[model samples]
Target: MSDTFSPRTLGILGGGQLAQMLALAAIPLGVRVVALEPDPQAGARLCAEHLCVPYTDPAGLARLAKCDAVTLEFENVPLEALDFLEGRVPVRPGRGLLAHSKHRAREKEGLRAAGAGTADFAVIEAESDLAGALAQLGGQGILKTSELGYDGKGQRRVQSDAELRAAWDDLGRVPCVLEGLVPFTREVSLGVARTASGNLAFGPLVENVHRDGILRTSVYTGGDQRAEAQAREIARAVAEAWGLEGLMTLEFFELPGGELLVNEVAPRVHNSGHLTQDGGGVSQFAAQVRAVLGLPLQGWKPPLPTAMVNVVGVDGLDGQALEPDWGAIDALPGTQIHLYHKAHRQGRKLGHVNLTAPDAETLRSRLAELERLIP
Candidate 1:
């Protein structure tokens, strides 16, 4: 926690692009990251100094515990693993909040308790219970997995009773949460960081666009007093309520009548805030590192307007071509692309590009230009 204090090692769970980016951001600060992931080809493996075997391995937690502090890039790390290591090493955004995020029902319940708005929902544990929950929600709704679902996985839209039953089966009959469909205007997310000392910081609001459950692009819409204030107020309340001490992103639905409904909560650096790397006072990764390391939080200040584009696997495109594309993103005005160095796989997150401009209109135009250039 000292300014001159250097940690010999930082442990990370779920070594994906998020961990990789956190490691990259921590280098200048003299922090070394060790990650635990099953796949050797994971994005963070390229950078982490050590891999703690595979996650869920008791031996792995024991190994990672030798570090000064442990943090998880993904929330899916089993609560048991974290609980086992809790007293041995410091884990930021600790299990208290993460335990809730792992389940959709708990997440919604927590959001409502924090005075945040969300679509009407009910917990669905059986196929027979689906109809009643759907009826309570009225008309059509989306069924989200209770645990371990992300990027549109483990979820389905149920408009009919037949679809509800099949959707329940499709989700492997796991405990689920049913949410009434919202006629949302757009999806926006707010990224906030809270330090162990209770210092909190909020970032710019971003309008996100997702395709097939995968985030495709994020447009950094500058702080609207009403929108940003609402999001910030809600995030701060959640952090204080949960006593969260790490970076967290709150995804919200901006609905008609200017109301915002909580969509989901990500207790780490989020995909929607990728634009912060190039356009914010401090990138979300940097802020996360700062918070987890017990450093002071930075205030929210965006570079006018920013746009972030994600790179997903595409057919017939040589993976080797990514190098030149990186050059293109770098050469373009106010744009930066981060490649995850992951093995080619369909629908997997490969990397992201952050672009900024002097204004929203210019940012939009630049984003459109990059869109054509990416593919």
Candidate 2:
């Protein structure tokens, strides 16, 4: 094993805030980062070598291949772009993991194969399959596209054949999955890190709160020992099944009966894991930098009783700007504010607040207050 993490220049496939934070983590360790993104003002431009071009632009891909290694900031990077870099650069966590992250049906299949439980679902390849798939799931399901869906986009709740057909059509008649809704008590997410040597580390199995199908907050409230252990074990199993080599975040639905149903997975640093940057410990971004360089993994967990609230900005389509009261947020005790260098847009994550307390109850209270103040 290498005594030092070796990727002197890391390449990221997208230049969103996740890329921004990843570069911030890497720079402290003397690793330079390059980001290829179409958005000229993308967040990573502040901290990384920005290539403001499409993901598949030949010149952009050529520049990325010059980096020591490559990874994704988001899962939707076109597979052909990866194919172009396969032998030219090391793409940690690789294209197979990206494949599952890109397609809901493949993600479920991979999860089941990995000994992780998922909500019962049927694949809809066409309109003729939608009715039977709906009936198989008790005639009620969330119809979601197999690819290119996130947040509340590309999904619809349907209870009948007509509704299912309509959802399929509305979603552009793409391949889809209709999943039975689980009777969940809460949603949770776990960030897992693995290395080429097969070492594994885990973040807390933190409870997550979402609104309008987007994550609003993630809180690690001195979580249940048994459930946390189970979540980590499941993550390890999934990592093995998926050939994971760096950071990945998995979403789960915690049922009232104390079981977990895997909901979704992301191949890079996640919105829910943003609290990792605080607490004076190794973050998912740091771990990713190390993993991509083949460095040893360290620090399995973060300080307990931490929470993060996303600062969603105003509706840009309404021609509004976010004039945040920065002083007000800074005045709140233990709050660390991180803003992405991007314009305010509705449904876009502009920044986040991470805070901690000596215990879980106080942390939850602070989180509620922070959430109220974010907008």
> Candidate 1, residues 8-108: lDDT per residue as tens digits?
57789888899999998887778888888888778887778657476778888888888878888888887777877899998988988887777799989
- Candidate 2 residue-wise lDDT, 164-197, digit = tens: 8888888889899999978899998888888877
Per-prediction CA RMSD (Å): 2.5, 2.0
Clashing residue pairs found in predicted model 1: none
Q: Pick the candidate with the highest TM-score.
A: 2
Off by over 4 Å in 2: 1-7, 315-325
Model 1 steric clash total: 0
